[model samples]
Target: MGADNQFPVIQYVNEAGSLKQDEVKLHKEQLYQFYFMMVRARMMDKKCLNLQRQGRIGTYVQYEGQEAAQVGSALAVEDGDWMFPTYRDHAATMSFGHSLRNLFLYWKGRLEGSIPPEGRNIFPPAVPIASQLLHAAGAAWAEKKKNSDRVSIVYFGDGATSEGDFHEGLNFASVFHAPVVFFNQNNGYAISVPMEKQMKSKTIAQKGLAYDIPSLRIDGNDILAVYHETVKAVARARSGGGPTLIEAVTWRYGAHTTADDPSKYRDQQESEIRRKTTDPLLRVERLLKNQGWWKEEEKERMEAEITKEINQALKEAEKFKPADIDELFDHVFAEPVWPIEEQRKQHKRLSREGIQ
Candidate 1:
């Protein structure tokens, strides 16, 4: 059988929001918490897109349609766990307790934006493809050597799986039994490239099998499935079961970044249709209604509250003085290298000449 046939997409909730698995852990209060958290991340993502267009921030990476995959996996980890995120994975970082103000500041091009909350081990968003996987693997290996219970979770895309670091990270993790979760958000496209065009393997999960890691494929739009399966992966890693790879079969309904036009390469109608049929937020909303647990007033209140929270973070970010240009050169290395010193001097000279 083909890998796709062998690894069926798992889900605890259908796209219509109907519960498929009657697990005891899917209680009322916790489900509501998950709903609220996803909503917060979604709202923040949308607002950041608007902020980018308004020239209030720098280029942004939108994660509009894959909230369940990011949020569910984020919520599965415990405090002190490590998270290495790609530029598009802020939803995961935020759900894992990154500061909203810092997130805003990040897009505003301030170094402070990279700082995680006190005691939180969230890494700065990696703009480079597939590099953070090594960081995650190394950190997890470090924790294992210390005999600590902490595990690391790294987020990447379908395109990243093609990078050598992805394979190296997995191979190292598998061989050394690094306690990490390699979470792949298969959003159907690597920017303009589709999955079929980029990979010959029928499924991303099968890639993990090559490294001898336990792997699973799950519905990224289903929060229940994402949360439960991720919880299992985390538990296994924590218990010294090494690493697990999860390929979240999902989609991104927007541009790869604010700088790119997705419409140039793909049909927009598919996104429009998928928003109705497979939006992670909509699926959860359906589930809530199906359970008779949804209230229009509560949803409205949640939206209003989240909007206010986003606004407060925005205000705090805007209040900062423009970042010093030296911050860029200084942070590049512990001591100034010749090239950096030359660049810093050139920039300062340009500023004085009003050419900046």
Candidate 2:
């Protein structure tokens, strides 16, 4: 059997929102909390897309269809645990205590956006693909050396598995027994390239096997499954069980970013079909309804509260003065190199002359 067939997708909830696994018992409050986070993530995603379209923010990445994967995994980690998110992982970051106003500032190209809240170990969103994997591994190793219980969780897309850092990070983690979770959101595409065209490997989880790290493929749309599986991996890491690779099978319902057009590569109909059948939020809604806990009035109130919060964050983000262009050159080095200084000067000169 191929890796795809070999690694069965783990799921706690089926399409009908019924619990498939009796072993995993979830309380009513926990389910409500998960449902709220998923709804908040979806609303934030939609708001960001609108902000990008209105030119209020720069190119934005949407995580509409992957809310369960992001939110569930984020909630699995504790207060001091480290989080390394990608450009498309705002949902995860936000769930992990990242401020909404700062998230807004990030898309506006402000340096302050990268700063996490006090006491939060959230790293700036990694724009350079799989590079954060190494950073996460190194951090996890450092924590292990310090004999701390804190583990690091690094988020990346399926495309990142093709990068050298992905393999190196996994190998190093395996060899050193780094306390890290290699979380891969296999959204079926690496930008315009589908997973099949990108790699011959049947599943991303199989790649971890070569490194001798325990790995599993899970239904990313099932929030409960993602949370429970992640909790297990994190516990193992804390207990010196080394690392685990998780492949979250999910889909993105929008363009790779606001700058790219999905219609150029795949059928838009596929997204529509998935939205109807496998939407993460819809699944949670179904579960709530099945339990007779879903209230339309409560949902409406939640929507209103979330919208108000997002609008307030936007206002706060907009209140900041425009960022200094020199920030780009200054943060690259402790002391500016001659070339950087010269470039900064030249940029200032051009600005003084009102040149575009």
Candidate 3:
């Protein structure tokens, strides 16, 4: 009942570093892309954490242990596909060609960070939890109406499933056959409340059954599995096959956010153990070694290259102009309402008097 039995966890590669099928050939370049992005995602997370500690940025959400779930699924989506991400899905957004400098700007609390690259239909990270699901469904429905092949992939955590919008999104997608993939990264806990404490549903995938949608559970740490399964889901959606709910059961090694301590609720040692046993990057490296394609020079070069890129982006983010005081009042509504106007005036007056 704890682990999904009905929707058995699908995996292409096992923890021991062996591919499930001998015929599943992979090119070195493809593997490198997967490895590089996963590493980049983790590195970005680490850099942001350090910046937050140094007061260079605001509190950050870490997605260290869930890189495979994010990066693999991200790579599965096509260039023109839409991406709806949660705050913790920087890996996905980055893999989908989001600007690294802008991603840095986001944690710095600047509005510029919210914008996606030109031609890349990436939505700003929805911090309000499952609200993005409704948006994804709506966007997919729009595409369907237009007779386009575009699909929307929305990322949400397990906790979001309990929200009313989750059901609403799924129901709408089901009834209308919206081409949206409900990608759920079930990272055991929703901030702090563990899955068992919140819902009795044995698995998140089964929730899709109620809506009569195809669903599956996958080993989120297995990058190959994540990529392959997601490719199928995305392809299905693009082909007008309706929505697919994918529950990637993964783990987070660090605290929920810089503001909270995971140790208070969960044992930190378990994370250390999981690092050796199920770390996504390590699994890929193992696969490379098993395939006799593991090259130290290639890895070293990648590390250097990615480090340079991340540092350059960080510098660029730091070069941005200081946030304007008026930004707080700019976008509350198209035409300013009295409450927003009143608050703006009050804030300006307080600032002029050297008060917060």
Candidate 4:
């Protein structure tokens, strides 16, 4: 048997926009909603890249190619479910009702961006890799103890599997029957290091076998597959079926972040090829066209609407004052530690004296 037989990639729609699974019914409204969110996310990612180039935001992470994986998995969860996203998962957070203005403010390095809207259990982006895995596990375990049906979904990259927290989180969740979905977007590259160089595992989904967590690998670019798989995982978690690990096989079409150069490490031509063949948005578009649900005028209207929404969010983000230097020290503890207090005082004195 080939790899396809060994590690099956769940997909409802083929590249030609034909339904591979006849049992799965395609809803026009649902398809339109998915397309809208994907387009919105793509637009936001492009705008942020431009903002970074113009020095309007700090180093920004782009999520252009992974929209279907992010948006589909996010939309699968319920309203009260907790979301632990990485810096590259603003697409997911935005789909889960995170504010666009707050996302922009995060790239601007403001602490306020970390705060989710009222009753939204979205954690700030975890920049330290797999650390959020443990947090997600703990939160899920807590909800389990509370006898609540809520589940936690934690997003991470392929590189995070190497971290100790990854194993610890899975082991704990398995032992305690925690309701958490470990969502891994295998985007082929961990920064400049390709997946082949990173690990010997044939598939990231197989990693969960050791912990006895139910796991599967799916075609991340197929929005229907992603959505269906995640819905099942969420349902399993809610029904006391314990943890799940989903490895969404996808690709990144750009540099790891705005600060990096992809040309140095990867063949740019490969990304171009993937863009033409495996783009997430294009797949949805093709499916829509195949189903006779696509309208050029509707797409144009969506673009205009999304552009206006993003521009308004950008304006709101820009209106915020520059972050105060001392505000960082104040949040470290309820009361500032002596060393931090001293450093804050010294920095303030230097600023007053106009000294470097």
Per-residue error for 166 in candidate 2, Å, reads 0.5
Cα-based RMSD of candidate 2: 0.9
Q: For model 1, what is the C-alpha lDDT against the true structure? A: 0.92
Q: Between prediction 1 and prediction 3, which has the larger lDDT?
A: 3
Q: Clash pairs of candidate 4?
A: none
Local accuracy of candidate 2 as per-residue lDDT tens digits, 73-155: 99999999999999999999999999999999999999989999999999999999899999999999999999999999999
Candidate 3 residues 1-356, lDDT tens each? Answer: 54466799998899889999676788888998899999899999999999999999988999999999999999999888899999999999999999999999998889999999999999999999799999999999999999999999999999999999999999999999999999999999998899999999989999998999999999999999899899999999999899999999899999999999998899999999999999999999999999899998988998899999999999999999878868979988999899999999999999999998
RMSD of each: 1.1, 0.9, 1.3, 1.3
Looking at candidate 4, what is the lDDT of residue 51? 91
* Cα-based lDDT at residue 236, candidate 1: 97
Q: What is the lDDT of every predicted structure here?
A: 0.92, 0.93, 0.94, 0.93
Misplaced by over 4 Å in model 3 are 1-3
Q: What is the TM-score of each candidate against the true structure?
A: 0.98, 0.98, 0.98, 0.97
| The 10-residue segment with the lowest total lDDT in model 1 | 19-28
How many residue pairs of model 3 clash at the backbone? Answer: 0
Error of 3 at 177 (Å): 0.2
lDDT of 4 at 317: 93
The superposed Cα distance between candidate 1 and the true structure at residue 221, in angstroms, equals: 0.4
